[model samples]
Target: MDPGGRVNIFVDTFAWFTDPAHYTGSNAVQVRVFEHLELSALAVLIAAAIALPIGLYLGHTGRLAFIALNVANVGRALPSLALLAFALPIAFSLGLGLGFWPTLISLIPLALPPIMTNAYVGIRGVDRDVIEAARGMGLSEPGILRTVEAPLALPLILSGLRTASVNVVATATLGALVAGGGLGRYIVDGLALQEYDRLFAGALLVATLAILVEVAFGRFEARAVSPGLRSPADAL
Candidate 1:
């Protein structure tokens, strides 16, 4: 159509978002937005649960560093779309539920690399002199990890988690392609209907959510990091 036709369509879609009737109810965009938020949150939490400990262990042990780093690198290299495609058949064969589970599986591989790499770096980056001091004081391996290494490494580890969280939040949108419901449904539906306005709105909302989560977690990370690790001036 003409530019005027496109302009009118945009105006109408904008009006829909503002219209109370369209903003409320089971069918509303608002509901779908919340669903997206919930899905992203759950997936990130589960991913963190799996990634953090393994990352920490890999970092502390040093023996597994090569394997962990390689796995993470492979995760980074693999496309989520490809991963999801491979997971779908396995998921079906195992009788695991589709949609969210497969989506979650796809995301875990995507999320792990940053966490593992960061944890390894953070631990390895600790001041060797400090580590030596701790060992000189009779600290066991576990003791050194818990009291010295992990605390020192926390800020960096959190940085990695932050990166993973944001990536998962954005990638979760792909879930809609496989009938995994989220805000992505809006984008997919809008695309199918050739509704550019709705598609842009969905994309905008996803960007906003990602930024919000990153900012919120960043503050939490700053607060949660061990006091000893903070610079002397900043710690005060």
Candidate 2:
């Protein structure tokens, strides 16, 4: 084969996406990819459900703020792969099995920090005068939170969600380490077989997917923060 012909081999790996003979286009790949996406989404959603409320409470009360902030910091400091390795044994012990749940558990710590930090910062960043004005208008604490503070903080909170979502999507590739299933399967297998073309295909697919999700979430976030506001400053 000529140089160009040889290069074509690497490019042709993407054809596996449509090739029934390869795992990438087979049922196993479909099942694994879907499972990985579902697990990542579920973990992030759960983390958001828990983190947002706590963050808001800490931001508003100005109590336990340090604790919440430090927890997020520590979470960010921990390496994701190390956490995954650690969770593997624990998950097996708990009878959650060795595959999906353990991998999902590892991703939670990776996903939480951005959501919590952004939520806390967003709420706390709201103007004190606006908060006082809400109180002056006889708005209850919850009312202030719902109508005043949350509205102001919405943009920042969404920003955090956007960050968290992207992080989870990228990190979810590690799921394959535990046989939890994802595009990572191709990468690991490719490395084992010395198949650079297959590895490249997996990496390309992952990057493309991550970018697409990030862009989609960013648009959704923009809408969530402000239905009418088109610009960041206006949303804030």
Each model's lDDT = 0.82, 0.80
lDDT agreement of model 1 with the native = 0.82
Tell me the tens digit of each residue's lDDT in model 1 across 69-96. 8877898999999998987887788887
Pairs with steric clashes in candidate 1: none
Per-model tally of clashing residue pairs: 0, 0
Q: For model 2, what is the alpha-carbon lDDT of residue 206?
A: 75
Q: What is the C-alpha local distance difference test score of candidate 2?
A: 0.80
State TM-scores per candidate. 0.88, 0.88
Q: Candidate 2 residues 25-121, lDDT tens each?
A: 4435666567657887888998898888988888888888887789887879998899899889989999999768888888888878889888889
* Backbone clashes counted, model 2: 0
Error of 2 at 5 (Å): 9.2
Residue 73, candidate 1: C-alpha displacement in angstroms: 1.2
